[model samples]
Target chain A: MTTIAPAVSGRRRTKSLGSLEMGRPGFAWAIPATLFFGLFAIVPLILVAVLSFTRWDGLSSPELVGFENWSALLDDPIMIKSLWLSLLLTVLGVVIQTPLSVLLGVWAAGHQRNRAILSAIYFIPLLLSATAVSVLWRALLDPNFGIPAQASWLFGNGNLFGKQATAIGVLAFVSTWQFTPFHTLIYQGAARAIPRVLYQAAEIDGASTVRQFWSITLPQLRNSMITSMILMVVGGLTTFDTVLILTQGGPGTDTMISAYYMYEKGFRNFEFGAASAIALVLVVVATLVSLVVVRASGYDKMRSTLEGM
Target chain B: MKTRFTRTVTGTAVLALGLSLSACGSSDSGGTGASPAGEESGQFHVLVYGDATNKVEKQIVDTFNKTSKVKAVLDTIPGADYQQKLQTIINTDQAPDVFFNWGGGSIAPFVRANLLLPLDDYIAKDPGLKSNFLPSVFNSASVNGKAYGVPMRGTQPVMLFNNKKVLADAGVTPPTTWDELIAAVQKLKAKGVTPIALGGGDQWPTLMWFEYAYDRIAGPELFQKALDGDKQAWAGEDSKKALTMLKQLIDTGAFGDKFDSVKFTDQGSPTLLANGKAGFELMGSWEYATIQDFNLKFAKNDLGYTNFPSIAGGKGDPNNVVGNTNNFYSVLKKTKTPKAVGEFLKLMYSDEFVKASLAIGNLPTTTNTEKFLDAADNPDYLKYQFNLVKQAPSFQLSWDQAYPPSGIEPIHRAVQQFFSGQIDADGFIQAMQALPAA
Candidate 1:
């Protein structure tokens, strides 16, 4: 017993020494990465943060202006409207795309014969760049010589969803088309991970297909749905390229997203201070939203549930 | 995971290497000092706006290099994006030693920022330069009595028509008066021919029409007053009359049904006049090269040039011309040797450079270069020069080039809106007034 105890303590000491060695290797890999991130990402972000509190015309050195840029943001109607529009797009994208992707994914998974073909078809949009998609959709949604116009003409035309709604609808549709494939892949993997025994047991107990899907399939896919939802929310919040190329925040700034408005302010008007302030606000809002979504969706609980299943 | 790590390392190494190499190259190029022999040896970078493949620009640059000590490097950017590129370079303190600059408000921002060096002292010491360049050409380059650039060429707006076709179809000669021009347009339209082909699709071309039309109606005095911030109402009766006349021309379908859709450079509209597709085109002297490229033939008498038709009740003279000097070169304030740059400018304005520019159908701004305009060599060139000097009361600068940057864009947009029927006379005037005055 005495010999075994000494040996056990020696093994424990060796294990602790091995952990210290592992920690050194981890830090060796981390130092370069940290340096890189500091140079490119952290430095630029800190610079932008500093510039947000200063008045800089992008020429000459910036002058510190305290909270003037932040105060000005309250009175800027265009920026406020753009912020609201961005939030609306983010909410709508998540609400509409997340369920559609899961349903499509589940249905595609059941059709084993054409699974590859259907997946390829669904993934076609993901191949296209945002600018290319924007151009293609811009042509498709143009008021003149566009697919929508021709369709409306056959049905008799009068302001489809009233001009403002038409723009929002088009933006949402394009965003969905671009993002659904990514979510669908996630959901398909989740669906495949569901144990076949659960379905078999439900079938033996006289549970119908719909009931089996609700009880077995959905419960299993909860973790993936949460993951896809988070991705969708974050992606939608930063939507800029498609909207920039398609509408340029036009029709009287009705389609201006926060990112697009910031670009216009910074590059077009040389209002870097104001743009940086807006960017800081966007970062804060995005962080708060992610936290709220992660907590409310019970992401950790779902992850544990999936593991237990 | 291993592949991703390798890829990230490769990307970082490449980015750092590329940035360091570019920094080294720029510093090396910039560090070359001026030679003591009044010759630039290493490189003299010139930033120009246009297609680099342009024959005329190539010939001028080639001739200048062969005759001078400087090895010229031409950087050509498209005209639409040139200002943005130039502004970025200037802001970064990486301005080219010699760069092309448009005459008026286009150069004002650079001048105001103290980015451009004043060339007045250079011009003052050179008697040959003072004698060779036209007074008005020098005037165009001067801002607040200080010269910022050298005038390369001058352009004047003129009426171009298919001599045989237009005159024969109308059953009359080219119109010399406002009434006659209207009658001629009516005659041409009756026969299903477009009288004038103005590409309203491009906003700048549409703005040119307004400038020409307004200059003919209001003359230089009142127009200068308006441009000079006199605060006189531009929506007065005279301005309304001009707008109404412009609208009347539009109503008569003088520009034809598809004028708005026609791309300015393509579809052979400019070439169409040379090819006899239409009656007349109101264009600047720059069209001569294009006309020559199409191999069009015009007798000295057949080719007609005139000012925009004057309004019967307007105060402006019919002979008044809307024109300005073209893009000119200016030396940077940070140049290591200003004398070498001045010498290079002198070489560019020499007789040989003038001849090369004139041979390409460009109007030489130099007074001594009139030798190239001899009737025996080019009768059309000589006649145009004679007509310009005699007829034009004063060469009014293109409004786009003359106004401050902030003021210029709004006027351009206002004119475009006016031509598109988005706004009427009073509304257009109000929009113009709404722009911040200099």
Candidate 2:
């Protein structure tokens, strides 16, 4: 005991000395990243906020219109509908993607050759660009000559794009298909980081495999779940390219979500002011949703699941 | 500690230097576009819609550069984003000296902004600039009786393009009157085929049906009056009659229910026609080239085109045509070398321009176009379009182009909604009446 005490004290003294010598990185260390973020994100956001208060048709000089665009947007039915649709699509994405990715991720965490091979194959859809994926699905879902024609029993008349429900379903399914692997990868990394000692203790207590998973694995994944959910919520709210290439806010604007509507107003209709207002609303909404999720999930507290252990 | 601090400082300085250098490079490049007239002396930029047609524009620019001391550099914005990018850059210092425009409402906004140069003086100096092209085509670019653009490309008149085999199989000949067209639609539909391949997803393709129906029933006067800010024209009985006829066509299932799922831009509707799933498609003359590019064998053998069927007792002349009259190049007022710009405009009527445009299956509206018709590929097709335009009493610009650019989305939405049965006749009329005047 005496010999061990002196050795432990000596190690602690060395650790203290090493830490004292190592200086913390200064503000200059963050300069490059801060500058990049300022130029690309913050500057453009400020400009968009300024433009939202003006009437710019992109041809003539922008005229300051004050609250005109904001008031008009408030009264616009399409604007309201678009907001609702954005929320619906976003919620659908989370509901469909969360459980799917979680299961796949936990399964993929196993270090089996088959699991590795299957996960690699599943990751391919995530690598393709949103444009390429939308086009590929559009061709696949075509009513006359695509997979729908071959599987008419499943898809009646295959008017998936001409109706609202099916159109939204396609958007949700396509997004889930394209993005699940990304979330799965996140969960897999977290799942692998889980302590094996907890599982061993649960097994000693006569816990079944399912019960052990429910008691330990899920609780351990709390932090990763919050991270993955926030990402999904933001991704769904800003879904644009898939909608543009697939639906084009069509079947009489039934599928017109906020992002595409903003594009239509800005690029197609040349109503820059109104579009900027819509953009700001999108940004605020995404931010608020993320904040609510972070707060409700207790993610902001930064409490570690392994704190007691 | 000092060494690490120095390294950090050096790294940041290097990063700062690199960033500033890149920023300087970008600014220098941007200055080139802005100072083309002064700093980039003896040269002007000619921006056009980027497409297969750009090859001709490039050749024309090369021809001009070979002779003139003032060189013309050709730039192209891909067709889809051309209008938006043009408007964004037009009033800025980066604006092209000469740029492509659709001539009617397309340029009206630029003209109103005083950004465009009036070409009356140039035309006065060179009578051939005014006289070389067809009067109907040239007058399209003239706003408020002042010429502002030179017709550069071929005219595009919407035609009823059909699959010859499909029509023959269905025993339906190309209709020349409204009633006969309805009968043909029924016949084709009865044969288990979509009578018309309307790319409703695109919305603009759906608008072609309305343009023809309105012109045939209410005459070109109604739309022109509407464009001239006469809202009453949309509420007129003739307007209602046109809507009724279009509604009947839609109710008859002429376009299959899934048309809203298809798009012309992606070769969806054209593929439907080529594959014999659809009997007809009313599309611009460019449809010919689009199909030819994809399925050369099909375009060569089965593609058949005819004039839009006329209404029997219509107020409009049976010979009235509606589509893009022609694409034109309008000069920016800020151009320093108006003389060099004039020399470039002169090439629009040059023999080389006409021949090159024709070889690519473009029907140039030049008076001398007929002279080289035999020399051009698809001479028969070129001659057909030439005569159709030549004989037409009024070549109404497309409703989308006749209305200011801001009105396009509303117009497309109204027509699509009407066709899809989301709105009735009254809804369509109110929508049309509410469009901002050109």
Q: List chain A TM-scores, every candidate, in order.
A: 0.86, 0.91
| Candidate 2 structure quality by residue, lDDT tens digits, B221-335 | 8998899999999999999999999999999999988887788887889999988999999999888888988899888899999999989778988888888899999999998
lDDT for residue A163 in candidate 2, whole number 0-100: 83
Candidate 2, residue B19: lDDT: 39
Top DockQ prediction, candidate number? 2
Q: Please give the range of 10 consecutive residues that has the lowest summed lDDT in model 2 chain A.
A: A1-10
lDDT against the true structure, each candidate: 0.65, 0.85
Error of 1 at A17 (Å): 22
TM-score of each candidate structure, all chains considered together = 0.67, 0.91
Model 1, span A52-167: residue lDDT tens:
99976544568999999999988887778988998999999988898899888887777578888878998999999987997777546533234644686542332222245766
- Candidate 1, residues B1-438, lDDT tens digits: the string is 344433443344333423322332243234222222213445666667665224555666676678666566666655454654565565453557777777777777667667678887787889665566666556666676788877655445444444466658678567766678778888877876667766443445666677767777777675666766765547677777778988887777777654433334532356445545567777666555556655546533345555566667667777777655456787777666576577777755677666666665666667666666662356565556546744566666777777755565457557755664657888788876665543
Q: How many backbone collisions does model 2 have?
A: 0
- Per-candidate DockQ values are 0.06, 0.31
What is the number of backbone collisions in each predicted candidate, taken in the order shown? 0, 0
